[model samples]
Each structure stands twice: as C-alpha cells, then as structure tokens.
Target: MFGRTKEPPAAAQPAEPSAAQPGQGKGRPTPTRAEREAANRRPLVPTDRRAASASSKEALRAERRRVQQGRINGEEKYLALRDRGPVKRFVRDVVDSRRNLGEYFLPFVLVLLLVQLAVSSSGNNVLFLASYALLYVGLIAVVVDSLLLRRKVRRLVAAKFGDEALFRTGVVGYAVMRALQLRRSRIPKPQVTRGQKVA
Candidate 1:
C-alpha cells in the first residue's frame, strides 16, 4: 500500500504519581489535637515544691549578700535607692569634708544624761542647774551647726550640679542625716576625709 505504516503504540505510563519510598519522613501518623495538648500539659505546682522554695530563698539570700558587699565597697550600682545619685554623692562628700557639731550630738547628749542622773542622786541643786545650762548650750550649738551645713551644701550643690539639683526631693534631708551620723558609722563610708577639699 502507498500509505505510510501506522506508528507504534506509546510505552505504558502510570495513572498517578508513585508513593514515597522508605525513610522519607518520621514514618508515624501526625499527632492528634488531644495528644498534642496532653503532651504540653504540666502540673500547676512543681513536683518538688519544698526544694524549689528552698532554692528560691537561697538565691534571694545570695543576691542580698552581694548587694550588701557591693554597698560596703562603695559601688554606686548597689547603693540604697535613696543614696544612689550624683546629687546625693556630692552632698555626702560635702558633709564628710567637715566636722559638724551634730556628729557629736549623740555622745554629748549621753554625757549630759549621765551627769544629770548623778547630780539628781546627790541632791546637788547647783550641779543640776549647770547640767541643764550645758544641755541647752549644746543643743543650740548643734542646731546652729546644722543650719550652717544645710546652707553650705545647698550652695555647693547649686554651683556644681545646677539650681535644679536644689529642688531634688530629700536632698537637704539626706545631707543633714549624713552630717548627723558619726563619721565611722556613715554608709558608703566617706570618700573624702576631714579637711580634704572636694572639687
């Protein structure tokens, strides 16, 4: 026949894509919602509650110790909230650089008390009058000294930091407290010493 021969049949082809071979995945069914929820669930309280509490307390104690040591070493970062600031620091230095009469007030008062008690027991009217006069004089001196210190500190703070520093809450009280404390008992122990000028 003059017509061309018919074409051969095409090779057979798969109707759908082949399945995945071995080792292709986790090889397990996906977890259901309930299974996932159960897996994630936890007890409201820890299994070892006492141990947990003890550990927490120990950690808190360690933190407090660290802060205490840091403060003793005069580390600014660990200072008490009220004592941490340049204004407070400057005021502290000012107070430390001078000897305030208020610093001796406690000891002076204790002495007067002892003297008065002794005099009262002896029934000495003259000595009793002297003690009262001395107590009044000492009180007056301390008040005068404290007033002078407050004025000086305010002036210095305003000069160094700015006038705005004068308005800082509790700054004046902070200086006065520091001035009243025995030098040895002051916290963040005085950086500047007596007669040592603070710039």
Candidate 2:
C-alpha cells in the first residue's frame, strides 16, 4: 500500500488584496513633473573662489580699519628726546645718500656689466664666470637698494607729511606695486597728485 499525502482545503486559504487601493503603501507623494522641470530649469548660482577671497579680504580690511582708528584716537606715551639734535641731521644725511644710491644703483650695475662684457668676449670662459658673478652681485645690489630706498622714502614722508600721511602713501604705493607686478610691468610709477613734485 502507498503512503497517503494530504493537501490544504481551498476554502481555508486567505484571499489576496486587489491592486486598486487608494493612499496605499509605497505610493507617497512625489514632486509633480512641472515642479521637477522648473527645479531643473532654475539657474545655478556661481561659486567663485576669488569672491570668497574678496569677502575674507574685506573682513580683514574692516578689522584693520577698526584697529587703526583705535590707534589714531588713543593717547600715546612718548619719551622726551631734547638731546636728540645732531642725530636727526646724521640720519637725514644717511637717508639722502640711500635715496641717491637707489636712483643710480641699477644704472651703475648695468654700466659695470656692459664694461665687463666689452673687455672680455663670450668665447672666454673667464668672462662667462665673471658675468655670472656680476649678475649675482647685481641681484644683491637690487635688494639692498630697494630696502634703502624704502627706508629713505619713509624718512622723507615722516619728516614732510607726518605719520598718517606717510602710512597712507606707503599703503597706496604697496598696492600699486603689487598690481604692477601682477601685470608683469617693469616698474610702478609713484602715485602722486597733480602738480606734486617727487625727489
């Protein structure tokens, strides 16, 4: 005899739900086609690194202005220098000498280089070595001359234009120089008012 197999009755089975239920699961509200299309069509805001830099710079500038204003308005302590008489004259002389050197230092280096080149031909290795040595010397001279010139300018401004005016001039000069360098210009002209004479 074969083993008996049993099956569940059809009347006892649970009925499956139809697909036409309203507000059912997995049917949450999604964006409308027009809303999605409009969102996609919206203009994108540009994000420039330069703009961020500019904003940071503006904040820094405002902070500096506040600090500078405090410094200007605050009472300052000073040491009496009644005996500092001949020292001023000596300092002025030194500044004048440095300014004169600044005016002529580059030209002097160029002339020296030309003379050295004229005396020795490119075929000579000694001449080449000398030329390089002169070039290095010229570079050092330029650095020194620039520092001296800046010092001289500071002294002149301090003597003639007062501290605040000197500071303004220095800031303007620095900005102009930076701009010119960025543009790869040879030299930046001094920012002077019309009818103002420069020494």
Candidate 3:
C-alpha cells in the first residue's frame, strides 16, 4: 500500500479576531485577566532614586512631628498614664481655674536668695531677719495654698465623679505639681483659663 505523502508543515498564523466582532481589522484582542492586572499595576518604588529618598525623609519627619503634637495635646492613646482619664481632666480644670501662690514660689525664693546675699555682704542684721521672716512666710503660704488646692480638687473629683475616685490615684499630687508650674508651662497646656468656672 502506498502511504499518502505528509502535507507540508503549516506556517504559524497570527491570532484571528472572533467572529462576533469581525468588523475590526488588525486590532488588539481583549486582554486576559493576567494581562489586565499587569496593565493596571503600578510601582510603589519611585523611578527617581534621589527624589524618593528625599520624600521619604520628609514624610518621616512630618510623622514624628505629628506624633509629638498628639502627645502634647493629651490625646488618649498618646497620653502618659498620669495624664489619662476624665479624673485628670477635671483636676487640670480645677487647677487651671484657680490662682495658686505656689506658682510664684520659685521666683520669690530666687529674689529672697539675692536679698540674703546682698544683706550678708552689708552685715545688716535687721534687714537679714526681715528677709528671712518674709521668705519663711512666703514658703508657708505656698505650702498652705498647695494643700488647700489638693483638698479642693480631691473633693471636687469625688463629688463630680464618686467616692471611689477620692483616694489612692495620686490625683492630689498631680494637682499640686501642676499648681506649682507656671500657667503657660503646664503640660497639655491649660484648657481652662484663670477665673473660669471648672466645668
């Protein structure tokens, strides 16, 4: 039996358009899922190396500043343990609302120290005694003011919050410390102005 000669190998052909849209000529075919995804994808890394580095540094600095400001503002998550809660908020309000002699204690003591130095140099016994007495009185006044402020703040906290809030939280200590700080320098900055009623 004679075998049929093998047909010449067919040439590779380009992909043809589907019959559904045969009006088109030499047009690209609809993309497969992989092709579509590849087309839509973008590089996160910048093509310009130096520009990328500079932008990343600036972004990091800005983020750090934002976090610092958040801590300064007493935002809940960013706040220190001592600065958290409505109790501390109320304490800050009470301290901010009232005037305290303790705030002037440091400057007053500095002044007295200078006076003592000058008086000792001049050997004025009477002036030295007067200055010493005055300094002692100022110190006593500051201590008394701080104690009274602590009591008042604790009472207010208990009354507004509960008896459970009155003890063992170091709230009184916190208030006393804040009372001694200059008004402008208190951390979290005073939300209530002087002479304003504590809300």
Number of the top candidate by lDDT?
Answer: 1
Q: What are the per-model C-alpha RMSD values against the true structure? A: 6.2, 20.5, 8.1
Per-residue alpha-carbon lDDT of candidate 2 for residues 147-168, written as tens digits (9 for 90 to 100)? 6555655666567656675454
* Candidate 1 local lDDT, 1-199, one digit each (tens): 7798988999998789778798889968999999999999998999999998999999999999998878876789999888888888888889999989998989998999999999999999999999999989998998899899989988888889888888865678888888888999888888898989988
**Poorest 10 consecutive residues by lDDT, candidate 3:** 17-26
Model 3, 1-199: lDDT tens per residue? 3887888999989899757865666577878999999999989876998998999899999988887787767677777788888898889889989999988998998999999999999999999999999999998999899889977987898889887876756788999999999887777788888899886
Candidate order by TM-score, highest to lowest? 1, 3, 2
* Steric clash pairs (candidate 2): none
At residue 75, give the lDDT of candidate 2: 15
Candidate 2 C-alpha error for residue 146, in Å: 2.7
lDDT of 3 at 105: 90
Higher-lDDT candidate of 1 and 3 = 1
Whole-model Cα lDDT per candidate? 0.89, 0.49, 0.87
Give the residue spans of candidate 3 off by over 4 A.
1-60
TM-score for each predicted model, relative to the true structure = 0.72, 0.31, 0.69
Q: What is the lDDT of residue 14 in candidate 3?
A: 88
